[model samples]
Target chain A: MADGLDIDHIARLARLRLTPEERALYEGQLTQVLGHFRQLAEADLSKTSAPFRITVSDVSLRQDIPGETLGSEAVLRNAPASRDGQISVPRVVDDEA
Target chain B: MSESLHTLSATELSRRLATGSVTSRALVESLLARAKTHTVLGAFNSLDADDVLRQADAADRRRAEGKSLGPLDGIPVGIKDNIAVREQPLTCSSKMLAGFISPYDSTVAEKLKAAGAILYGRLNMDEFAMGSSTETSATGPARNPWDKDRTPGGSSGGSAASVASGLVPLALGSDTGGSIRQPASHCGLVGLKPTYGMVSRYGLVAFASSLDQIGPFARNVDDCELLFQALAAPDARDMTCFTAAERKPVHLPQNRKPRLGVPRALLEGVDAGVRAAFDAALEFYRAAGCELIDVALPTAGLAVPTYYVVATAEASSNLGRYDGVRYGHRAQGALNPVDMMERSRSEGFGAEVKRRILLGTFVLSAGYADAYYGKALLARTRIRDEYLKALQQVDALVTPTVPSTAFRLGEKAADPLKMYLEDLFTIPANLAGLPALSFPVGMANNLPVGIHLVGAPQAESVLFALARQFEGSHALANRIAP
Candidate 1:
């Protein structure tokens, strides 16, 4: 599994860009961690198909009235880049490249 | 610094405030001075003395007007950085949110404010609440007040340290896999991780949503209970919070001897010093008229691996919101939006945070989901079922909070797996979503040893009853950190 695992692909899927050093380090570390997880494979699943428990029932619901919410200025307080009461980011659509 | 006031519990301080013996501004100032003197402990990340002073004055004015909010009115309390406070930088001791100021207060903060407690400062924690020791903190680790050479167990190390050091009588901490209990144990303080959904999680920076529960750290059980009552209320903002009707009070039988379950197998590998401390605690329980019942958690060995799988999967998803676009730190000069996000996160998060994110992503990856994530969920159920079955005949389960006392700084820093194992005893309570409390029982090797008490669902009151009784009878009662 370690030889076949694509560390780069996993990092890309997770939207993280790891330095080569980080990639190598995490590759080894994750392998060891996942190896520890192999113990769960020894569990007998004859009785338990999937363990699901619903702690919250469907009965409780809050009223649908509009209430106090963060103002646009307040929401933009932590934005690294903002303009015109909105968070500005890198271009979403790209030119044909 | 008003040493006498610093030694008082929140409940005792509250009475003083009620009778006008001491002013809020004086209390806040004294505590702030205490914090400044002990800055070497690295317990707090950010403290605006001016803002804290202003809040204290406001609290004092309300008291002067005969309009005290509640039991916590005019009390000064520090908060763990992961839980939000309006206008404070919610760094969670990570570089990712270093400059990020919270636009709103978390439910716990809101409750504390409503009770008129001064939201004193932002306490240090494990980076993103990921590590057992605060060593992962981008700001630096919080040192144990008892002995500076050792660590105050974390990720709520700062919360526990602040209270134990007399910097504050109370502080709020979030426990996702024993962040609160372990630290409280190491620092010789009282910490509670109330039943899941007992407290609202609206404004907390999520590490593992389902497993995270906000609770309190205090010098005594009474103060812990007061803070718990303040924070444990339903909020529409958090759908998972327990409603008034859904939460039922658990009663301990008055006439019969309370039964305490001890998992003998689980206690096998504990350190000699910790084992001795546990035996002394058992003797106390036996003398106090509590029956000791031997119980077994057959699946307990799988808790660490199972926790990592489930916690990381949720952490990976919950932390996806920290991309460069919305808020928090963003990197410069990215060619495209995708590049911007990747670069930002790579630069923003710490090494420990990235490792967990990577593992989370790996486990949840398409083909591996069933083999890893699915199996983990089932194992979690088994652990929970084991606890529930054991709890039927016993009122609560007892174990050492950690296998040993606080270790020297950097002892387990190099090995991620070793650091993860620190949560061995505390993780099962989280997996089962049961309320657990950690309080100082005795000293081992000159360091405080904390015993963990796990109660059934909504059995917080019963746990407190047992803890209060133990605190009163034990020789370590009111043992303060030096």
Candidate 2:
């Protein structure tokens, strides 16, 4: 579990904006939290099986259907800042560009 | 003396409305008056006085037309902060969606409104329903009305406290793990968490989708039963919602002595007072005709872990929707999209939620999914199966809702592990995705102790009837917290 955690990289990915002081503080907090998951990680889960025996629900998902249109303009109406028929967000990555 | 005008239960209030003892507008005025005067209960996060009064007036108008006879007619019920009520902020007690007003009514809110219930206000809760205690509520910790120093239990703390403190007769609460039940226990109210898909989750701000179920909190057993009946019908909006045909109306067994399962193995680590209170409840049931069956659920111990892995994984994915755009709170003015997602989520989420999202993201990452999330799902199956297998031999299983009564606010706040362990008794119910109800059976150290009654899938009617019998007994009725 400790090996699974790479705090520096994970924090960077989350873009936590952790200050040097905050990072130091979070390192300790994150370690204790991850430690619990580690204990669960060690438990032998092979012998156990979840019970599917009791639940009963009437709801079921419908098969996918196409052709639903976003009524009129609301879809593009409230974009933070939009161009002609498009939501113009800042370039986040190469994909956006 | 007649009970205080503000302290009447939902059932009593409805009866009053039926007989024209109180008009809907008058009742709404009283409820608003009470809620405004006693704001320390921290029951509500946002309220629309105009909308609530308008609805009340409408119900009154309908009543004048010989309509509006629904069970909840004009009964003020508070919605949890996480739920969407059109035009009100759906903060989930987080800074992230600080002023995000909902565009539509959540199914539960819609259903409650259809039944003529007055919208009292929105209640406070943990940020995104992430943590157990209400302290994680970004707005502020919801103070226990019993004693403001202690928490009312959360993330449904506000709903429970609002009902418990005589402000509202009934309210809606969403339970994931022990969100509804734990707080209900601590606050001495009746809390219900129906089968996983019992109530539609359409408007519920997702916490852990697999574990979350919205139910009711009320003063008495019948109030809870009525509220459940009103809200339990399936909606086409939530695909996961259970259908009515599959849900049998829960009924009391006739001429039958109740057979209850007591899982002593699971009860081993319970605190002395809670254990004692549970024992007394068992004895009370025995004296009244319940035959106790000592049972064991082997995989019950792993429930908490499985819940964490699965629930957090789901929460991380669910909360990913809060990207600071298209919704509320867009980091004032971000430099870029990447900065927006990062800074907004970072500043928006509280400590407990961030920890879960981080843990969830880690588990779902390609490297660890098979190890953590996969294994947790398997463990969940076993835990659910073992309970189902055990329930086959008995009508329902009983246990202490929480390991102990409400501790000082910060008792477990510093230690995350201690806080997680607080769900030891209640987490199994969520893992099994079973229907459970927590009711105050007895008191401890002058605080309350709730006894949990777990039933077979869709067996809430059974839970209610048995609970009704318990509440009706004079001895238990008088067994209040000293």
Candidate 3:
């Protein structure tokens, strides 16, 4: 089985902040799930290839053309906070880290 | 006719509308009343009787003017909360999108509306379509109509429940790793997961994009087919949707009995009751002149693990957009943009959703990508090739959709691994991009047991044909919930 996942690093990479209880709960649960994935490593699939990469034509790519787009009002309607017709976000790049 | 309008199929409803035996308004009001009365089932996330009536009125006016929108005109259909329907709240049964109104309708919603189907309430689902049972919904669990104590298999729980309980004759659901079929199995209804890209996914909320396909749930195969016909079309909006000419099914010879493949390995550990029902279904199929062939899928055992790796990897990428700037729940009192995003996601998502996102991030992370994600993609190829090889000998594969009937609410929630195992039987089709349908075959302990027919890529019609045959011969087809 794979070693225990770094729960703290994973949460940070995922941009999630977990409580102490949650961290304990997830660390155990994730280990169990990853152990299941360990079974896949046992398979002898050295000759196998993904269907998408093998058959590249399966994906239907649309032609590049200008089409109708949602108006700015409709786009901004669900924003949590808006200022001057733009979505508002927390200030970044503070003087000190 | 109006008394039982809630129970009528979309086809029958359309006929009645054409004959003027029932008005769309009356049917909508009747279904709305039924929905309100059955709120104990937790089947609906958001509903507005006034809005439904208005849409129904428009349908009635269109019929009065003799310009009906084909057969689905005025049919009341439930939208699983994850699919966008314009002004409706696309909640996906999570707090993150609690009040987020969709700016545009999903491709399915748009197609259904153009066909004159009334886009009704937003049905409840597993948060972000991550769980097999709807218990993961932050909104609350959708109860099985068969027994309120048990869960309606999810994440299309509400879609299946609303149809099973006669609240709506039809509903649209997105299936990623058996989300649509398992619930249909548990609820004793018809759920179809179209071949990947057969139906557009433009406005449907992304769970696992490559595996997810929008499909339908109904009481019978015909309604399922009609809903699928209306929803399946080439959409310039969704690059993945195939053109009609590109998806033609391979034809079988005339006057030949169709061969059905039975994957013996996957059936080994099913529940006793489910096994018994499956055996009976096989007997029924044999008696009906189908040639049952034993097929081998050696890598079928790897489906669950491979699904988690691939699905989570895609989910982590898709869900990255919910960083609190554009829409959805935002956190308060944060020092920086990064801190705000962290808290907003942590607080907005449910535990199951967070678990998946974390797992997904881990697999895609630099050090682990080759070990987990890359290996999973290779395993997926092996399974898909195995299935393709097996399908060459048979028209389709038949297996139990879920190992058992609906388990009690919270039965498998505690063990995330146990819950992940629930998708073992259904995930292979998703990995391979094939069409599969689940329909009731029998009842065990008063709960419905479902059997699925998996067909070749873009072979939805073949699956539907086999389902229609089984549905016709069985007593479970039109059985109503108590």
Candidate 4:
């Protein structure tokens, strides 16, 4: 069960900045939700394997030939900020570094 | 004639279109008018009357040239906002994608257009398909047509509500857990969640990749099958989709009474109305010669917990791409990229979506990964195996679609745990990647009660046949919202 502090860490990892109210609310809710999730421990999974993978027998792959693709103009249409037919974002790296 | 056109099933409408009794344009216009009057249902997020009429005119022209596509040709179908229809809004009913227009058609949308169906409306949904009730949508909750004050079950609530209220005869919905089936039950429509990978997920906003499946909601099993048939095909775009040779034939065979397995334990806590309706359906199947056997799913109790862990883990990873960068909503001011992402998501996402992302991030976190996410994967394997084993003994497993009828808006909104439990009966099918169908069995207190059927992978035909047979005999068939 995640506490208020734990939720802060989780929110950071998820790239979400939660309001104090949301943090308090989610803390209580997630704790209770996790308590419900504890029932999963009761399952007898000794014979089972972890990291379940769906194995489709026949996965047909298309040829390596390039096909028609969305133009940069169309692709950038939905971007909130764009410049020169490309999506623009706040600089990630420290320019001085 | 136009007044009643909105109520006709796609099958009946197709027959009428074949004989030139109706033009697609006229039928679309009639439905559009009905949709405007019934806007109180909150079923659609965005609809363009002119665009819908244009497609309808194209279908009409095709018929005039004797180049009709098929039964789906000329049918108006509502699309869940999560599924991309090129040049149309694909918001997923979240503020994150408020003005985001899809640059490409999803495989389902492509197929629908190729089949000559007029794609209409961006149906509302739980924000990012996170909630069990449509109340979480940014567009506001989609109210149940049966009871205006009540919610249509979600995250495909709008899909169910639209079809139920006769805004459109057919609609598309994505099921991750019970999103499609639960709403279909609440709205008294037939919804199917096909075996995972049976329908291509390309262009579908990914919630939980392994669990998510795009399926159809229709007035009847036949119409549901018609839409499913149109959508189910090999797509190179989604590698998980069945290959051309791997795709199983969907034809319902001759009338063969199926051996149905009932997990009596799972039905214990269901509402009395739902239990009674389920038992009555079972009794009808038995009297009609179906062999009903008692089945045990010991791990079934673990489905809800296991689903939350697994679905959230995948969702957290899948949603990482929405980091205020290329597309979707971007925050106004931020000193850095990371700050921008955090602020944008925090501002754009609703409470439910934020909660899920937090839960998912926690489960997949370093120290907790083994305890929650890893444990869930093992439990999921067991649950899947249990379902597969049960299906070996019986052609299908029958249960109630949801524990109860359409819940009033905000009834379970404050309690996340209670809302998650709504998918208890339907989650096993998704975990096991099996085809499942939900069809209205009866009504209780003026709300619809639906029965659920889970079949083996690629066993959609069996589910359809059984559901169609029951729907044919039931008086509740073809019922519409008052």
Q: Identify the leading candidate in terms of DockQ.
A: 4
lDDT of 1 by residue, A51-91 (tens): 73536755456778898898988888888899888888888
- Please, what are the lDDT tens digits per residue for candidate 4 over residues B139-176? 89999999999999999999999999889999999999
B263-292 per-residue lDDT for model 2 (tens digits): 988887888998898898899899998889
Measured over the true interface residues after superposition, the C-alpha RMSD of each candidate is 1.5, 3.7, 2.1, 1.6
Q: What TM-score would you report for chain A in candidate 3?
A: 0.80
For all candidates, the clash counts are 0, 7, 0, 0
Q: Higher DockQ: candidate 3 or 4?
A: 4
Itemize residue pairs with steric clashes in candidate 3: none
Flag regions of model 3 displaced more than 4 Å.
A50-59, A95-97, B251-253
Lowest summed lDDT window (length 10), candidate 2 chain B: B473-482
Q: In order, what lDDT does every prediction score? A: 0.89, 0.79, 0.89, 0.91
Error of 3 at B181 (Å): 0.3
CAPRI quality band, candidate 1:
medium
Give DockQ per model, in order.
Answer: 0.66, 0.39, 0.68, 0.74
The residue ranges of model 1 lying beyond 4 angstroms of the native Cα positions read: A1-4, A95-97, B475-477
In terms of docking quality, how is candidate 2 classified?
acceptable
* Residue range B228-332, candidate 1, lDDT tens digits: 999988888888888888889786879899999999998877999999988999999999899999999999999998899899999999989989888877999
Q: Residue B298, candidate 1: how far off, in angstroms?
A: 0.9
Clashing pairs in 4: none
